[model samples]
Target: MLNKKQTNTIEVSSDIAQVIQDGQQLVAYMAKDGQVSLDPDLAQVMIDAKYKLQKKQWNAQDEAHFLHSYDQLAKAVAPVSMESIRAISRSDNDKPSQAEKAVAWYRRYTLVALICLLFVQVYYLFGHALAHDLKDLYESRNEWHLKLDSEEPNSKEFKQIQSKYEEVGQRLDANYNLLKVWNRIWLMGFSFGSEIPPYSQEKLNVELRRLERAQADANALDNLNLAQTRLTARLQLFENMLFAQSVLEVLQGYVLPLLYGLLGAFIFVLRDLLREIRAITFTTDSEIRYRLRLTLGALGGMIIGWFLNPQELSGLASLSPMAMAFLMGYNVDVLFAIMDQIIDKLRGAMAANDGSKGKSIQGSGNG
Candidate 1:
C-alpha cells in the first residue's frame, strides 16, 4: 500500500540510521589499538556525519558526503565494513512479516509430524526385514528337514543335514529373541491379549531334542515324522504371524515406496528450510511451494516404486525400488525429466506406428 515516494523516504531513513550505527561502530573499532587506521580527513568527515546524524540535522547532501567518507575510510582501514553495513541494512529491511511468522509456527508442527511419520516408517521397515529373514530361515529349515527324511539316521548326509538344521535353529532362536524384545517394547498392547499366541523357543528346543533322541528307534520313525510335521506347522504359523504383524502385503505393494518418498522429501525440505532460515531468505510465499514439492516427491516415489524396475536398468540393477523412490522424492525434477523422456519416446513410437500404418494403407490402395 506504500506509494513510491513514501517507500523511498522509508528506505532513505533506514539507510541513514544504519549509517549512524555503522559510524559509531567504526569509530569504536578505530579506537581499539592496532585494529584499524583511517585517513585524518576521512576520519573527521565520519565524525562530523555521526554528529549531524545524532542531532537529526543531516540533509540528503550531508548523508551522501558522509557515505562517501565512510566508503573511503572502509577502503583504507576495513574493506569488509561496507559489506557489513549493507548486510545490516538488508537485515533491517527484510524483517519477518506476519505471514512468515505464521509459516514458522506451522512448520514446527510439520516438523513434528514428519518425525513421527519417519519413526513409523522405520519401525515398519524393520519389521518387514525381520519377517523376511525369518521366512527365509524357515524355508531353509524345511529344505533340510526333507533331506534328513531321505538319509539314514547314522549316515554322513544325515549328520550333515542335522548340523545344518541345528545351525538354522540357533539362528531362529536368535531371531525369536529379537522378536520378543521388539514385541515387548513396541507391541505390548497387542502382545498381552492377542489371539495368535507367541511362539515358545524353549518348547521348540525341547521338541527338537525329543525328535533327535527318537531318530535312533526304528519303531518311533512315524512319531519322528509327526513331530517334524508339527514343528514345521508351528514354524509356518509363526512365519504367518510375523508377516501379518509386519503388514508385509501392504508394505510390499505401494506403502513402503510412499513412505520412503516422504522420508526423502522430508530430508530435502528440512535441509532447504534450515538453509533458508540461516540465509534469512525464507518467506511464507514459498511455504505452499514447499508443501507442493513434498507432495510431488511422494508421488514421484510411488511412481518409481510402481513402474521403475531397477533390476531392468543396466546401471541401476543394484538399487532397490525404495532407494529409487527416495531419490526421485528428494529431487523431483529428476522424476519429471525422466517422465518427459518417457513421454517423448512414447510419442515418437506412436508417430512412427502411425506413419507406417499410413504407408501400408497407401500401398494397399495402390495395389
Candidate 2:
C-alpha cells in the first residue's frame, strides 16, 4: 500500500512558504557583508527542488516568481550554479526556464532510449539481411555436394542439390531420433487418443524404457554416418541456415517487446542516474549509482515487459504503434515511482551516516 509522489509540488503550505522566504532573506543578508557563505543544507534543498520540479511545464510568471522568490537561496547551493539562477531570471517566458529544462531532458532521454530500441530492431533486420546475402553468395559460388546414398540423381547439379537437402534431412532425422524418447513420454502422458486400459501407468513406463533403448540405437547410427561422411562442414552450413531462420522468427516476433523492454528499463534507470548525479556529494559514490541503475533497470525490464509486451503481432492481435508507445509511457510512470523510493532510501542512509560521524567527531574532540 506504499504510495509515491510523482510531482514535488509539496502543497507549499503557508509555513513552508514562510520558511522558504526566511531562508531567502537569510541568504541575501549573508551575501552582503562578505559573509556570503550559505547554510549548505538550505542550498541543497533548493538544488533538490530544481531537479524535482524540472519535469513540470512552467510559464513565464512561474519562472519569474521562482527567481524572484528564491534567486538568493538558489545562489547558495553548491552545484546550483549562477548559470542555473540566471536561467530562471533570463526570460519571463517560462518555456525557456525550468520548463524548458524538462523538455530538453525529455528529448535527450528519449533519444537515448530510442537508440537502445534501435538495437533490437537492428538485430532482426541484420539477421534477415545476412541470411539473404549468404544465400546469394552461396548461389554465386555454385556450391555442390557429393552424394553418398545416391538415388539416381536426375542431373549432376540436381544430384548435388539433392545431396545437400538429403544431408540436412539426415541430420533432422537423427535429431528426431534423439528427441523420440521425449516424444514417447509426451505421448504416454497426454497423447490425444482413446483412454488407456487399467494399469496403464506400468504399461507407459515399459513403453518409455523401450523408447530409450530405440533412441540409443538411432544415436549410434548417427555417429556412424557422421564418421563415414565427414560432411560436418556442409551440414553445419545447412544447420546455420535453419538456425538463422529459427532465430529470425523469434527476434522478429519479439523485437518490438524487446525494444519496449529495453527502452522502458533505460527510462527507469536514467531518471535514477540523473537524480543520483544531481545528488552526488563527497559521500555519494559513483559505483553505488551505477549498480543502482542496473538493478532498477533489470526490475523495469521485467515489470514493463510483463505489462506491455508485444504478445501477438498478426491479425487483430497486433498493437498499434501509438498504443505500444502509450503503454510504455504508463510503465515509465510506474518506474519513476520505484525510483523515488530508492532515492529516499539512499538519502536516509546518507543522512544516518552523516549523523553518526558528526556525533563521533564531537565526542573525540571533547575527549
Candidate 3:
C-alpha cells in the first residue's frame, strides 16, 4: 500500500569508503513500499537526478555533451504524452521503401503482355494446325485424283461421291490451292522481297495452261474434265493452305512468343502479387483461391476449344475441306473473343484495388 505523504527511503550502502561529494547529483528513487528501488543507471530515465544536475550545471544551451544528452532524455521521458507524440512524429517521417512500386510496374507490364501473348499463343498453335490441315487437304486431293482415276463416273453414281461427297466438297480445291500459293508468295515477298519457292512451278504452269483452254468447247473438252477438276481442286486447296501456313509462320515465329513474353510477365507479376499478399498478411489463402479459379477456368476453355477439332469433324460429317476451314475459322474466332473478354475482366479485377496503402496508413496511425 502506498501513502501519498510518505517519502520512502531506499537503503543505499553508505559503505562506499567515502562519498564522492562531486557525484552527489546522482539520486535514488524508492517506491512507496520503501523496498522497491532502481539505481540511477537502471532506473526509468525521468528520475535520474545526476543527469538533471548535470544539465543545470551546464551553461551551454548547445552542450554538445553526453551529460546534457542524458539529462535531455530524462526531461523528455518525464512526460509520457510528449514522448508518445515524438515517437509518432518520428515514425511518420521514417519510411523504408517496400519495393511495391517496382512490383506494381511489373504486374502492369505482365498483364499487358498476357493479352498480347494470348493472341500470340493461339495464333501459333492455330498456324501449326492450319499447316497440318493444308497438308491433309493436299494429300486428300491427291487421293481424290487416284479415286477418280480408278472410278468410271458414267452411268453408275460415283460410290464415294454418293456417300462422302456433299455440299462442302463442292467447293473448288484448285481455287483454294491457288489462294494458298498466292499467300505464300506474298509472305515470301514480305520477308525477303524474293520470288516464291520454285518447288511447284511445273504443276502451276500446267494448271495455268489447262485453265486457259478449259473454257472452250465445254462438252467436247469433258474428256479431260475429271483430270482438270481434280488438278484444279488440288490447286485451290493448296492455295488456301499456303496462305494460312504463311500467316501462321509469321505469327508463331515472330509474334506469338513475343506476345507470350508479355503474358509471361503477367504470369510472373501475378506470382509476385501473390507473394506480396502473403508477405504482407502472412497468408496465401486469397491468392491461392483466385489463382486456382483462374487456372481452372482457362484450362476448361482450352479443352472445350479442342473439342472442335476440324479434321475428324470434317471427315466424319462429310464436310468439304473448304467448309471445314470456314467452320474452324468461325469457331476459333468465337472462342478467342470469349477468352479475350474473360482475360480482360480478370485483369480489370486485379487492377481494381491497392491494399498496400491501407496497411501503411494504419501503420502510420499507430506510429
Candidate 4:
C-alpha cells in the first residue's frame, strides 16, 4: 500500500543502511591496521544514524548526515580503499541518476556500432578472397591461351590445352555469376553512374559458346584466338569492376578508417570504464567525456588515413592504413603530437630558408 514517494524513501533508506554498514566495516579494518582513528563527533553521528535506521526513523536528512559522517571517517583511510567502498555503495543502490541511464544507453549504442563495423570488415574480407580467386583464374586462362598458341592444331598437347581452357572458362563463368549477385548486394546504392557498364551475362554466354565451337572445330585457330581474346577481355573487365567496387563502393576513403577508429576508441573507453568502475571514480561527467573521446577517436582515425603517410613514420612504416587508423583512434594524442612535430619542423625549415635568402641578398648588396 506504499505510495511512490514512500517506496522511494524505503529504497533510499535501505541503500543508506547498506552504505553505512560497509563504511563501519572498513573503519573497523582500518582501525585494526592503525590507519584510522575516527573522530568522536563522527563516531556519534554513525551511532545516531544506525539507531535511527534500526528504529525505522530513517529519512533523507538522516541519510545525508550519515553520508557526510562516512566521508569524514573514510578521509582517514587510504584513498583506494575509500574509492572501493564508494564503488560498492553505488553498485548496491538500485535507483540510478538520469545521467547514468543516458550513459548506459550510449554504451549499448557504441557496442552496436562496433558490431556493425565487424560485419563490414568480414564482408570486405570475403570480397578480397573472391578477388584473389578471380586473379588466379585469369592467370590460369592466360597460361592455357599461351599453350594453345604454341601447340599445333589437332595435336594431343593442343587438345589438352583446349580442355584446360574450357575448364577455366567454366570456372570463370560460375565466378562471374557469383560476383554479379555479390555486387548487387554489396554495392546496392553506390553503383550508380559507374563508367564500366554492367557486365552482360548474355555477352559472356555468347563468347563462351563461340569458344566452345572453336574448340570443336580444332583447325579453327583464328576463331579460337578471337574467342579467347574476347573472353579474356570480359574477365579483365569484371576484375577491374570488382577492384573499383572494393575501393570506391566498399572502402570509400574515410569509411573504413572512421569505423576502425571508432572500434579503437570503443576498446579504449571500455577498458577505461572498467578501470574507473573498479576505482569507484566513474561519474556522469566521465561518461559524457568518454562519448566525446569516441568522436575524436573516429575523427583522428580518418585524419591519419587522409594526411599521415605511414611510410613517413619511422617505426610505424609496417602498419597498414587501417591499422594506423586504429592506433590513432585509440590515442588521438599520439596523432596530435606527431602533427605538432611536423609543424615545428616545417617552421624551422622555412626560417632557415628565409635566413639563407637574406644572407644571399646581403652578399649581393656588398658586391
Question: What is the lDDT of every predicted structure here?
Answer: 0.67, 0.51, 0.44, 0.71
What is the per-residue lDDT of model 1 for residues 105-208, given as tens digits with 9 covering 90 to 100? Answer: 55675576467667767766776666667768879888888888999999998999899999997896676666555555444435432232335545555666
Worst 10 residues of 1 by lDDT: 189-198
TM of each candidate vs. truth: 0.50, 0.30, 0.34, 0.62
Provide the clashing-pair count of each candidate structure. 0, 3, 25, 0
Q: Distance from true position, residue 162, model 1, in Å?
A: 6.5
Better candidate number, 2 or 3, judged by lDDT: 2
Report clash pairs, candidate 2. Answer: 59-94, 60-92, 60-94
> How do the residues 338-364 of candidate 4 rate in per-residue lDDT, one tens digit apiece?
889889999999999999999999999
Displacement of the residue 14 alpha carbon in candidate 3, Å: 50
Better of 2 and 3 by TM-score: 3
Number of the top TM-score candidate: 4
The parts of candidate 4 lying over 4 Å away from their true place are: 1-93, 97-103, 189-236, 239-253, 306-318
The candidate that wins on lDDT is 4
Give the worst 10-residue stretch by lDDT in candidate 4: 189-198
Q: For candidate 3, what is the lDDT?
A: 0.44
Ranking by lDDT: 4, 1, 2, 3
Decide which is better by TM-score, 3 or 4: 4
